[model samples]
Target: MTIGELAKRSGLTQSRIRFYERIGLLTTVERRANGYRVYPPEALVILRVIAIAQSAGFSLDEIRTLLPDDRAHWDHDALTDTLRRKVADIDALALRLAQRRAQLVTLIDEIEARPDDIDCADNARRVLASLFDGD
Candidate 1:
């Protein structure tokens, strides 16, 4: 498959795919005689893994370290440590999300509780308070 076909199939931009290849985050891809990039079906799987890892807050540089080599072997201790670190990261994100949700809920409650004739000038203050008052 060509670069365009890989981008379409993997839901990534062609530039991003090429960027990964350039940075060695992706393995070497076969090039056509015409100099166009060609990808195998497995490349899509790797791309999806890259996307998920990124969403989980792993930087491309870090991901490169986690990437398996062509030999398909990894150090068990290192892999365990990486999983532990990722779990810690996810826990911190969950805490932040919970705090954000509480703040949003307070904002919604305040909006719902506002008096029918409340001064328009105070509405903005109420919202600001809801956001920063995180209790």
Candidate 2:
């Protein structure tokens, strides 16, 4: 298929497909006699895989490493290990985000718990003391 057809089928813009080819991510392209690009049917699948991997948080470099030059020659163990590591990284990020969220909630509660008798400056000092000295 031509670059336009590939772009239509892959739901990617022509420039993006060309960019991928230039970046060595899409390497199955051939040039016609008139200098037009021709792509095999496998290009569509590869593009879909690239989009999926990207959505899954795999960077282009990581996807390049994970994708085998020959589809039949994928290293199963390496793929599994990499996926597991990504999952672990995501888990660690989730833990940190949850901790941060909890801290924000605590801070909100502290800020809202100001006494009516205190001025804003004194309440600010009280909050700071609780945050620093109480910790």
Candidate 3:
């Protein structure tokens, strides 16, 4: 198939296909007599895999490392290790986000618990002090 056909079938723009080729991510390309690019059917599969990997948080560099020129060969251990590392990173991020959410909830509660007699300025000072003192 031609570049246009590959782009249409892959659901990617022509420029994006060309960019992938230039970046060495899509290597199964051949030039015809008129200088037009021809792509094999496997190009569609590779493009789909690239899109799925990207959506799974794998960077272009990471994807490149995972996808070799020879489709039959894949580093299973490296792929497993990288996936585990990404999961761990996601877990750490979730913990941090939960902590931040709890802190924000605490701050909101503190602000809402201000005394009726105290002015806003004094309440602000009290809240600031309580936060700093870890109260």
Candidate 4:
């Protein structure tokens, strides 16, 4: 098939396909006498895998390391290790986010609990002190 046909089948733009080829993500394609590129049917599946890996938070550089040129050369152990590491990173991020959320909630409660007669500046000082003192 032609580059246009590959783009239609893979749901990627022609320029993106060309970019992938230039970046070594896509394998070299055959060219005809007219200098137009020709792609095999398997190119569609390769493009889909690249898209899915990106959606799963894999960077293009990481994806390059993960995906071998040929399926037979795939390293199962490396794939498993990389996925496990990503999960660990995600867990650590979740913990940090939870801590930040709790801190924000505490700040909001402190503001809401401020005395009606207190001035805004004093109330702000109290909140700042509480946050710094880890109250």
Candidate 5:
């Protein structure tokens, strides 16, 4: 297939495909006599892996390190370790997000309980000042 075909097949732009190649995220493709890129259909498999890895929160460098240099060189142990570390990182992030959600819920409750007959603007100013230690 050609670059255009690859782009359409991968749902990426031609420039993005070239950039991925330039940045070493993708292997350099062979060009034909007409100076147009000639991509193998298998390249789509690699591109799909790269896209899914990125969306899964893996960095470009991490993905590069995680993917096998070649299919024949695949290592199951290394893949397991990397995935384990990613799982730990995701767990930590989830815990922090839950804490943030709890704090937000408390703040909302406080706001909801604000005195209705009080001067709301002045009360808000005082609340903001106390919250942030402002003037």
Candidate 6:
């Protein structure tokens, strides 16, 4: 199909298709006699895969590694490894976020427990001491 038809079918702009071609993601693109880009029917499926991978937090470079012209030839080992690594990354991020939330909650509790007779500076110092003194 022509670039426009492919764009309409793939839900991607023509420039995006061309950019993918330039980036070596869409290697099946052919050139017509008039120098217009011609795409096969499978281009739409490839574009959809790219969109899905992006939604799944895969970078274009990673997607490029993950995809090939033939789906049957996909490296199951590599795909599995990458997926496992991404899960680990997400797990680490969740742990860090949890720790940060707990720290903030502790700070809020400390601030709220401050006696009304203490000034802001003294309260801050007390909070810092409690936090750093490992109590």
Q: Which candidate has the top score in TM-score?
A: 2
Tens-digit per-residue lDDT, 8-109, candidate 1: 998999999999999987785998898988888878878997898898898888787777776267677876788789989889999999999997787788
Which wins on lDDT, candidate 1 or candidate 6? 6
Residue 50 of model 5: what lDDT? 86
Q: Which stretches of candidate 4 lie over 4 Å from their true place?
A: none
lDDT of 2 by residue, 29-84 (tens): 99989999999998998899899889989999999988888776889999889889
lDDT value, residue 89 of candidate 5 = 94
| Number of residue pairs clashing in candidate 4, backbone atoms closer than 3 angstroms, sequence gap of 3 or more or interchain | 0
* Maximum-lDDT candidate: 2
Which consecutive 10 residues in model 1 have the weakest lDDT in total? 67-76
Can you give the TM-score per candidate against the true fold?
Answer: 0.67, 0.90, 0.82, 0.85, 0.82, 0.75
Native RMSD of candidate 3 (Å): 2.2
Q: Which residue pairs in candidate 6 collide?
A: none
- Cα deviation of 122 in candidate 1 (Å)? 12
lDDT of all predictions: 0.82, 0.91, 0.90, 0.87, 0.83, 0.87
- Residue lDDT tens for model 3, 1-135: 998899889899999999999999999999989999999998999999899888878899988987877877877898788878878887988999999999999999999999999998999999999989984
The parts of candidate 1 lying over 4 Å away from their true place are: 96-135
lDDT string for model 5 (1-135, tens) is 889999999999999899888887677488789898898877888899889888989998998887776755769899889989999999999999999999788667756667777687877766676667633
Clashing pairs in 1: none
Estimate candidate 2's alpha-carbon lDDT, on a 0 to 1 scale. 0.91
Q: Mind giving the per-residue lDDT tens digits that candidate 4 earns over 7-82?
A: 9888999999999889988884888999999998778877998898888788999878877788557798998898
Clashing pairs in 3: none
- Name the runs in model 2 displaced over 4 angstroms: none
Candidate 5 has what TM-score?
0.82
124: Cα error in model 2, Å: 1.8
